[model samples]
Target: MEWAALLLLALALCALLYLLGRWLLGLDGDLTLLWAEWRGKRPENELPDKVVWVTGASSGIGEELAYQLAKIGALVVLSARRENELERVKQKCLEISNLSSKDILVLPLDLTDRSSHEAATKTVLQHFGRIDVLVNNGGRSQRSLFVDTKVEVYAAIMELNYLGTVSLTKHVLNHMVQREKGKIVTMSSVMGIMGAPLATGYCASKHALQGFFNSLRPELGEYPEIIITTICPGPVQSKIIHNVFTEDLSKSLDNTGDQSHKMPTDRCVRLTLVSMVNDLKEAWISDHPYLAVCYLWQYAPTWAWWLMNKMGKIRIQNFKSGVDADISYSQKKKA
Candidate 1:
């Protein structure tokens, strides 16, 4: 009887110590990453010669992803609205990799144009026969208060960011479903997981993506070979800030914030690829302390709300001062 009592006491003490360690030592993140690694939940298949279709490949993370994938021997399909920029990216990819121009198809795509998705898919399949992965990395950003923003702005963002991505995925998904093996990778933002100031439409679109993909995951359970990965990155150094939409749905060209502190685009893409290779269902790729905010939002809702409210007020003040008010997008330029 004494031994049994002692054993119970020891177990209780261990549990208490673990909880303390998780809180005071902040070992939760490391422990979680370790567990994921131990489970071997990441994709183990090598990427050589695999056909990867990347949207928004003209610049930023998508462009970097294409170059890296090509270096690893993946046949990359580069897509965006600018054919010239796509060609430039293709050439750069070719220069760095052993792939020929024939291996990299420069496919011009406008995400808002739903009518073009069918032909786009057909063209991809005609060239590569099959798509092993589809990376949906194209979308716009918002930088206006919900009250000041036009209704059309919301629709425009939803059309391009949500519906357009969904439409393209639908076209490609049919082929993936038939093949019984494929990957769907998307670039959602930290805003998707938590709301932020001057990002009502943007947040809504990302949140919608989260819902759509999460619901779609269970339906694809029959096809164990198919994997869906959602990457949520926080404040990466990219042209996204330059392309933010305003109240009138106009592009803001004025840059704001300290981008030097943000994660480099190359590093962001590298982390995203690592998550993809691991076959993570959802992952946050950020160099900043944004992961802590994600955790707080998830576990301590009231605290997150209070923090966001404070941040939102600061953002509003910045906007009013015209410090970061010029966040907008223009036509794609040749890289």
Candidate 2:
């Protein structure tokens, strides 16, 4: 009887491990985020009537964010460098959602313009009375190898991606502090958590953001109502490839390649909304093996480094071949 019980237990353990492995294979986000999406507060219930200020509102994830927020009945503040693009996005929001023209504000903002951020914050306050959620999504990506890249490119990336984000956060956070409540969501990348070969500057900037917000969250313990959330999405379908900085400040990526393999933008935004409403400190929204690598990075540094080195070689090779650096390893090699 004892032997039979032990065999059954071993069989159950093996079955459980098999099930866990299968589940892990299909996971696109970190465990906490999936939990929130499953059981936490829904964005529709939480965001309605709230004021959300989205930077880079003109295109890519920011544009999608405006649409989703509008659909959910949140007062939207659309901001980007181009007034025309912001207006276009605003028009689309109005057409798709029940939001009136007054509900969607087209406020053109150049995030790199540090001097203008203060005025931008004041304008949102004047219009909305209070800011509920600030989405910092404006930033560029890098595609060149560090040795070939100019120092000015690195400086420009930091100035825009890191410092510009921090500048705006300072102003909006002040307002949140006054109210003792608000959510600051910065769109960081997976590169922030783990280093890659080609995006040295971009990685540094995101790492700075991760470190900054991680520290800032602790300091804001006095204002427990204020939430600082950093979202690290691996790769989503977007036009970011077309806008990546190359070896020189004056140069641009030659071949954008096929970005179809990336996760859908709307799906990423949906997960983001879930993370936001739940006040998750940090969420990794990515499909494996990127998602798998993040886990390895946290729990097994040596193994993660070994895997990254192997993947980084492929990434660098892809870039050199004038294709997307992050194209699927099997697909690239097969082709």
Candidate 3:
């Protein structure tokens, strides 16, 4: 009995050490991933002096990204639907520093409009003479039940999130390729990898982003100078929830406002910038590195994440499927 107890204790210690090594130390596979990153060797900063266009720069992550890039002397072009809001954000950026005033350019656009993207690109080139980076970050969330969703809702979400991003990138790719240098930063969500309830359309769009960016990365590598990056983050404490579409296909969404009070917006955008400048292929952000662990355990036969998600509030069982099922539908019609 004494010998058995000692063996069990030793086994437990070994298990704990293994877990600690993998978790805290990050000694998992793909050390080559970090090695692949450009890291300290940035290319004499083609980033700052050249034009960098940011989508959805009116608020939240986009707004913060614009300001941060501006601070770095990046000639940042801001785009979004809300002209007034974008103006306010641009003004605030200018107020923060004079570097931003000369570098920041506000050009409001609805990503759903393909022509707008082309026009925006033209404007950027006309204004700054060259486009060096494109940040595709403008996206909305759907908080409706899948069953009650209208086809329009799904179409709209896909049009804006997937098609819009691809269209803009496609428009500017020729120039970037000709220049033989550029960076494409795509913003995906944690929900992109892990499907959350009541977000079928949103999830599909984000997953599409991952697939599209991943495939394009290799092609861009042909240039060896153009870098492609995809970012995945769990919910951040932002106004994104307020903008999420509900069942009624309503723009004014207040029902599913994510009040979880999680990560700060500044920190989130800053990390995204760091990841971008470092030329990282991918980065996953969350309170914990659960997303990285998910990547490690993704190949397991059983869908352990599905089982684990089902047990947590993150799964959101009460979520309705289609737009009609969401409370925002009726609320919007009433308004």
Model 2 earns a TM-score of: 0.95
- The superposed Cα distance between candidate 3 and the true structure at residue 46, in angstroms, equals 7.8
> Which whole-number lDDT from 0 to 100 does residue 306 have in model 1?
86
Better candidate by lDDT, 2 or 3: 2
* Global lDDT of model 3: 0.72
lDDT of 3 by residue, 199-248 (tens): 88998999999889889988776799898988777667667877887666
Residue-level lDDT tens digits of model 2 in 1-335: 99999999999999999999989987889999999999999999999999999998888999999999999999999999989999999999999899999898888888889999999999999998999999999999989898899999999999999999999999999999999999999999999999999899999999999999999999999999999999999888887778888899998888998887788899999999999999999999988788889999999999999999999998988888877777865322235
Please write out the lDDT profile of model 1 over residues 210-277, one tens digit for every residue: 99999999999999989999988877778777777888955564546545555678867766766676
| Counted clashes in each candidate structure | 9, 0, 11
On lDDT, who's better, 1 or 3? 1
Runs in model 2 lying further than 4 Å from the true structure: 1-15, 330-335
The TM-score between candidate 3 and the true structure equals 0.81
Give me the candidate number with maximum lDDT. 2
Candidate scoring better on TM-score of 1 and 2: 2
Off by over 4 Å in 3: 1-47, 257-260, 289-293, 308-314, 317-335
Off by over 4 Å in 1: 1-45, 323-335
TM-score of each: 0.84, 0.95, 0.81
